[model samples]
Structures are given as structure tokens and as C-alpha cells.
Target: MCKITSELNDLRRPSLLVDAANCGTEAYQRRRDLRRMLRVAIPPTARAALEKLLPIEADLEKRRRMGATTYSFARHVDILVALLAEARAFRAS
Candidate 1:
């Protein structure tokens, strides 16, 4: 006699389990994957905003390397904040 197993029987597989250490690592990896996907999925305008911001970020790093004054750093910080806000708003649209 031939016997067939019900589909319901296949649903009895073991539950997914994650340890504390691996959980953090897995979450970080997932975030990296999501960021990579977003980079690919961003619209042209959003990508342009990112492109514009990249040089400012690099310039900030350069200024930091050159021991820029606190005021200069603060100004750069404000510019970065505004750029970030503009990018967020553009993406929302």
C-alpha cells in the first residue's frame, strides 16, 4: 500500500532559534544588507542629494584632519544636518 503524508505534517519543522551573541551579529548583517538594497533602490534625486553630501562629508573629515576650530566644525555640523533633513524630505516625496 502506498501512503501519502499530509501537508500539515510538513509544518512541524523546528522553530527558528537565535543566541544572544549571534542575534546582534545577525541584526548588524541584516542592516548592512538593507542599506545596500536602499543604495540601489534610491531615486535619481535622492542619489543626487547623496552625491552632493558625500563631498561635504569628505571636506569635514579633511578639516578635522587639519585641526579645524570648534566654530568651523559646528558650522559643518549644521550644514550636514540641513543636508540630511533635505534628503529625508526629498525621499518622503
Candidate 2:
């Protein structure tokens, strides 16, 4: 007899999806730092929600909401490295 799988569970492969909530927590903090470093105005009280929302938010909207330009966030390769590193560090468990 042969069995068929009805669901695809790619997350089972495990690069980091084990603790999504925790990763989200870190991503949230990194986003806040990114906004602050870029001088984007974010309400102190809204930090948590913003952090939680940043990853899924469209890039354009995220930039608009944060008031950051591509020049500021990604113009230089160095900045991109730092930003990406920070993001990865935060998301890493």
C-alpha cells in the first residue's frame, strides 16, 4: 500500500522556524532600532505593534511609514550589510 501526504510542511526542515514568536520579538526590536537610526519618527507606544508588523508590511509602505528613503536604508552596501546582519541576529534563535 502507498500513502500520500496531504500537507506540505517545509518548516520541518528547520533553518529557524522553530520559535517564530521569539524571532518576531527580535525582528521587532531591530526594526525599531533601524527606524531610530534612520531618524524615522515612530510613536514610542506603538513600537511593539510596529515591530510585529514590519516584516510583513510592504517594502514601500514600510519605507513610507518609517519615512526612510532607499538612499538612507540601502544606498551604501555597508549599510545594507549592517542592516541585514542586525536583522539576522535578531531573528536568530
Candidate 3:
């Protein structure tokens, strides 16, 4: 879990992207994969939060493809990180 968080932190670095389109792509994919794992690992009670976050993350990716600004990409990363934190907490509980 700490390794996942570290990967996310690396993805958050602005220097990772040469352009906005790819800024969140890798992180988005990683997050999606994590979401899949989390859905099963986390308790059923926390599934509602996962459901709410999924579409938001998808939209953020869409925005990125649509040429969202670097700041928007950064914000997207922030939201993913928060979602991961929420999932981690749910798993820990």
C-alpha cells in the first residue's frame, strides 16, 4: 500500500509529463487498477464511496484528453490520491 502511494506521488510530479494529455494517463490507469483491487479488498460499506469516485475519475481523464491544463491534471491527481487514502482507511478498518 505504501508502494502504491509512492507511485501516486511520482505521478503527481509535474515533470513526469512532457504534455498535459499524458499527465494523468498513467496515474489514471494505475488508479483504475487500484480501484478494482480496492473494490474487493474494502468492506461493502465503503463501496458507495468507490462508486462515487469512479465516475469523477473517469471524467477527469476525459478532461485530460480534451487538453485540460496542467493545474487541472494536478487537481485530478490530488483527487485520486484522496480516493486512495479513503480506500486505505476503509481497508484498515
* Per-residue lDDT of model 2, residues 1-93, tens digit only: 111111111112123322433344434454555465445554343333234333323343346446775523222222233233444544442
Window of ten residues with lowest summed lDDT in model 2: 2-11
The sequence of per-residue lDDT tens digits that candidate 1 reaches over residues 1-93 is 111112112212112211222233323332243244234443346435455544555566567667767426444543344344434545566
* Candidate 3 structure quality by residue, lDDT tens digits, 1-93: 554345434443233432443443345443454456345443334345555555666677677777866437555665566456555555666
lDDT of each: 0.41, 0.36, 0.52
Evaluated at residue 26, the lDDT of candidate 1 is 27
TM-score of each: 0.37, 0.22, 0.42
lDDT of 1 at 92: 69
Off by over 4 Å in 3: 1-45, 69-71, 90-93
Error (Å) of candidate 1 at residue 63 is 1.2
Model 3: how large is the Cα RMSD against the reference?
Answer: 10.8
How close is each model in CA RMSD to the real structure? 19.8, 12.7, 10.8
Candidate 1 — which residues are off by over 4 angstroms?
A: 1-44, 69-71, 90-93
Better of 1 and 2 by lDDT: 1
